[model samples]
Target: MFALSGCAQQASSPGADAPSGEEPAMPDNGDCPVIDSRDWKAWVNAMPGPGAETTLIVEGAVDMPTPGYTFSWEAGMADRSAVPAQRLHLTATAPDGMVTQVITTENVRYEGPAIAKEYRAAAVMCGDELLAEITDVVTAE
Candidate 1:
């Protein structure tokens, strides 16, 4: 299991019996009014399977100032260079209004395909801030 320091939130991945090459749907939070916090801890897990297909799961949690904040995995793009890497983007949004002062956590999850043995690392980013770097990628057999 991939681990992130100071992050207690856990993300679930698609089951092994699920159809191959089917991407999961992102949560609908398009109507949120305010942009939530970027303070987060991120992690990435690589699951290698047959046919040289690798599933990369990026997970993270943001520190919100109040409740009612929702987070989602915006996108994940692979940098195909001499050394490949995956860049996972995240966003946190909340309703417009004043809420009680309670610290909240919003978790995000992204599951996608990656070329097995190709990527050297995966980086999770929120806006311009780098949240986490995962270097222990499981290469193809």
Candidate 2:
């Protein structure tokens, strides 16, 4: 005759939470500056008025200020070496032919792009507080 032993164990309640293991780690992005365009494209819309101001709008913006429309791997993607320093200088000529310049500060950098669900979009103003004019608009991918 053989004898067997049995023991009963308690079960956890339905409300009890399960033990969670370690979470996955984020990929390493080295400190080196990456000046890639992230495959973003751009378009331009300019409405110049005879005596009035121009209207400008941009989309698909790269962060740190990479403004564009949609994504264009050909036109947008760039290696860190290919990334150019940002320039927003605007030059305007008045009716009298006097050339005036809107010196935009070098606020845009090549660190990376500012991508979100909708990309980057904005309406740029070139004039002063009372009257702002937008002559050129750049939208990107």
Best by lDDT: 1
Model 1, span 1-141: residue lDDT tens: 346554875665745445778644423344332234343322333444555445666555666667886666655677768657877776666657888866676666777665444567778766666667777555433
Q: Model 2, 17-130: lDDT tens per residue?
A: 445663333223332111221222233333345653322223222221122212211113212332221222222222233333332212221222322212222222122111
Judge candidate 1 at residue 139 and give its lDDT: 48
**Per-residue lDDT of 55 in model 2:** 24
Compute the lDDT for candidate 1.
0.59
Model 1 regions more than 4 Å off: 1-53, 139-141
TM-score of each: 0.53, 0.20
Best by TM-score: 1
**Where in model 2 is the C-alpha error above 4 Å?**
1-20, 30-39, 50-58, 61-141
